[model samples]
Target: MTTTPKHDERIATMTFASVYPHYVTKVEKKGRTKAELHQVIRWLTGFDDVRLQELIIENVTFKTFFEQATINPNAHLIKGVICGYRIEDIETPLTKEVRYLDKLVDELAKGRKMEKILRSTS
Candidate 1:
């Protein structure tokens, strides 16, 4: 079996709350609202506002956060490059999911409309 990369391991162990602020900052700098960020996160993770707040307050790791998530079926539709890595080319399941979130946020920051960022429903 292949060992997980050190980068993936480090990211999995990092607190979701720690990374969340960076996500917010990125989008806000590009004129996206916190509500839009929340919506994108909810769409991907299946966590409502209350549950998201609970996770943030608990300081869970990215691994724990995704483990608890009821990820959307539409998540597979998120395909693109983020930070020089292609989201679709990521072989690790957990890492791909994490990058999907990152790609969505990047799209929002780049001013893609909400409907397109969310992907096709049908």
Candidate 2:
């Protein structure tokens, strides 16, 4: 019964561009390439490189980002703990989507195989 923290409100309003660098930094610190990070983001959000760049240039908030996203049907396959919260256990739809991205980035940082992280478990 964990309540949504006040900080989550700020997170929802934060721009994707503002957070993009941190994601790049996290993955790059573990020897992952920015292209790989892009691939994961595209896989989750259905944003191609050009569209992704547009969102960054426009400084879209996470709430707006997900609002416009064509989230992959397989996204629910992403299951894990991130920042002490289980992705599947998150109650708010928007928060769960945000955490889904976080979990994917965490996997990328941890060096999980791209196919596994993308849940291409076929």
Candidate number of the best lDDT: 2
lDDT string for model 2 (57-114, tens) is 9999999999999999999999878878887788878888988999999999999999
TM-scores, one per candidate: 0.93, 0.93
Error of 2 at 36 (Å): 0.6
Clashes of each: 0, 0
Per-residue CA lDDT of model 1 for 1-122, tens digit only, reads 22259868987888999999999999999999999999999999999989999999999999999999989998999987786778778888888888899999999999999999889564
What is the lDDT of every predicted structure here?
Answer: 0.90, 0.91
The candidate that wins on TM-score is 2
Model 1 lowest lDDT segment of ten? 1-10
